[model samples]
Target: MEERVPVPPPHPAQDVTEHVGYRLKRAAAALRGAMDRALREHDLTVPQYSCLELLDEQPGLSNAALARGTFVTRQSANVVLRGLEDAGLIVRAAHAEHGRALPVHLTPAGRQRLHAARGAVYAIETRMIEAVPAERLPALLADLDTMAAALDA
Candidate 1:
């Protein structure tokens, strides 16, 4: 008779706090808190900062695109854009060059503000990366991407 091998049981969390999702949420909350404090010094909110970063890389993005890139709702993005416009940080075209998607552009002042805030944001990210070992940084990023993809699917 052939010998049979037993299957191992699946790993389980001992408590809710021990779950991977819970840990991820805790880390995200901490990061958000740190970013909030850091950005406040530059007179920016997290969503506004995210929008600025996106626009810096890809100028002339529409409201919907900005909303998706910033992980905010279209209505929320409109509000953010309005606030930025009022602050002289960004300008939306009066008429759409094509279709109804009015393009957004960063003003000189907007670029300057973003440049000023980038350092503090980068510092926070640097601190986060420093917490992990140098060799494991790639794996950590990949793991995060995998987790997000799993949920997206």
Candidate 2:
């Protein structure tokens, strides 16, 4: 005998633009496009910049960790790391000491590039921040964190 799970009844439909998820996606796309343009001037992509930023902060993250932090696939992170290597922006161990994953570190050039890229990215961030009320910024940021946590949970 098969037992069927009850399906919840559909709720009333609304315009996508009025929905939170739609707005989030739209906002994300705009931010990504703006970041792409800003980073392009520095000859770096968002994922590459993100990897460098993480490497700068932690200094020895594996490609998998970088990919996870950047919300990318491991293969994509590998490609980004290779590109950075080709640009003399980062280095990896010749062999892993404990596992198959090689830890990544930013070179001096990567630090320099990150310095410039940070300014551009911060400008974009500042623009977004300014759009919201200063008094509400903390609550807004916290709400965003809560939303992400809900999804993660």
Question: Model 1 over residues 1-153: C-alpha lDDT tens digits?
Answer: 989896543457666787788899999999999999999999999999998999999999999999999989999999999989999999999999999999999999999999999999999999998999999999999999998999898
lDDT of 1 at 26: 99
Given candidate 2, what's the lDDT at residue 61? 93
Best by TM-score: 1
Instruction: Score candidate 1 by lDDT.
Output: 0.94
lDDT of each residue in 59-87, candidate 2, tens digit only: 98999999999999999999999999999
**Model 1 regions more than 4 Å off:** 1-10
What lDDT does each candidate get?
Answer: 0.94, 0.93
